[model samples]
Target: MHDLIASPFLNSFVVLRPGRLEGIALPERRFRELAQSHGSGLAVPLWLTDAARSRWGIDVAPRPVSHAVHIRDAPVYGHSRASWEINLGCDLDCEHCYLGEKRFAGLDAEGKQRLLLILRDAGVLWLQITGGEALINPHFAASCRLAHDLGMMVEVLTNGTRLTSPTILESLTTSRPYRVTVSLYGATAETYDSFTRRRGAFRRVTRGLAAGVEAGLPLRLALIVTAQNAHENDRMRGMADELGIPYKEYTHMSPTIYGGAESLASQSPAHLKALERFTGCNAGHTFLHVDPHGRASMCKVGRDEQIDLMAEGVEGLVRLGAIADRLMLRTGGCSGCRLSGLCSVCRPLAKRYQEAKAPLNTYCQHEQKGDSG
Candidate 1:
């Protein structure tokens, strides 16, 4: 634990906008500029954590992405998966929602159309659709249809507030959308609603799943492991088995500096060890985050620093994909970390500290790994 307690670099924590270089202040081509301007070394000034600042005293210029594979639609070839949140505004206020409802950015119909086009053109087959709640969006069916039309395989991740509907079934009635992941926040309303702060949600979600299944939607359950739901895995698993629906679980931990920040960071290791699935994240580069805004990111958790797939288009997105691939290969974040293996989380792992010691985001002390067979 001494290493964990030591001051860590925190650049990845700083957020940035598109053309923003993955939230990094330094543009892709500007690394050498700083080198020529500064005496010898000058790292990008983008970190915001105190411990991080202290670790690397000098800001050494970062290594820019090698312009090796610059082909559009060329598979940088990875274990790649992509997710798109059709909307940010959700009906339920789950404890884990990093933005709560303050940063909702659900896509409009036109936005959805263009987004699906971008994905289809990019050849992004594996996708995850989320929201506020995607089902709540009037564009849900059209969105799914567009993805299906493009011959893309899809996955819909949603809270139970809206799911398993007769209408949803009709939309998913195809070979494209292989699965719909419904969150099992809790087994009972009393337990589920405690964190969601909503009443009658647990029941709605369950019924919704049944409705979807009845309508032929391939429904699966996702149980987010949390402090409150620490010991509920067995019950949830049992329920899934009894219902004959495949179930999966994820141990929760706080890695964001956003909403419910307190609730996220305070999970005890002893408790997390019991519920968490992995200690770190690997969803950003490993997983593509195509948002309702027509912006593409590495993963859902790291929604900042978007690659503008529309303005920049698919070719631009392909360039971003290459950069992301290089960024993931960075030694600054996960090189020496303990959770590097199961830390399959692709969200920005390394951080460029103020002190210049760029370390991986070690917030996830414990990771979740399970045989969700």
Candidate 2:
């Protein structure tokens, strides 16, 4: 997959041209099928051709040109930090939402201000606004403008219910969001409506998507996976394909310890484990969730989210973020396990392990079941 001749052009020292890529493992048959399907298996990024890269304004290749141990020694296409959730108060009672209904039940005014201040001062280059529904917040537009003014691109993740207005569109469009991610529950009304429990919500989400597309805004899709709907992941993903929106699927993984999916958190361990393989707790590194109560966690689940940002303040928390980096680099347990593409213990899960001596993982159990079969 990596060729030495291609290293100089694509290595850490030299930046890969926006659209140019030198190393890719597309040489395999199975991988080729995946490429023609699921985007080159995350190994090869679906990239624009060389000429197209010039227009897209990106220099990072979707695939690596080299196999460097250190990211510093490897090529980087994006910024160092990631877009994190600062607000959690939401109005919708989404059955599969990671931000449980209680979290978004409401937000204290003081807590909101504290989070905004933290994001603004953290040298954060990209800020994402999410909530029960970020757009519903009274000061949503003003807040978006504030973040945009700070020389950072603002990204919004919403249910698309409140964005059905001209003014809302204007405010968001003016901000030039990195992308507006809309959750697509199902391809059909019956399927989607049943899950959201909002009769006309499916229609509204579709309409909002059309308006966003017409406005030339980028769109991403979030598909929730539950026991009732787990078998339909591929089907929902196909819907995103039809809509031309990149989609990701998430299972309501509360595991009891982290307020998992209300009634089904205790789904068979085997099923939970399968999701864990791909949906492993990437909390500390991949995401940093902020709740309405001003609680913070690298991941949404895990009781250790006891890390209160309102108490620590932004300075202390930014410093603490390095802990996530350390936790990610760790190579043990699920994290350290040498399974190909298995989910490891995210920060939240690690906290669980420390707090409770029990190993109640679905992934491990699922694999064991397969062995028995």
Q: In candidate 1, how many clashes are counted?
A: 34
Give the per-residue lDDT of model 1 (tens digit) for 1-373: 0011101012111212111112223332333333343343333334322222354332222422121101112233332357777877777877665544435555668878887776655546456787768877788888887765554556787775665565766666643356677878777778877867788778887787677666656678887777776667678888788778888676645444231344454243444433234444444434577766878776655444678877887666645555565555536434665655554344352232211231223233332332221
Reference-based lDDT, each prediction: 0.55, 0.52
TM-score for candidate 1, please give it.
0.64
Clashes of each: 34, 13
RMSD of each: 18.9, 11.9
Instruction: Name the candidate that leads on lDDT.
Output: 1
- Best by the TM-score measure: 1
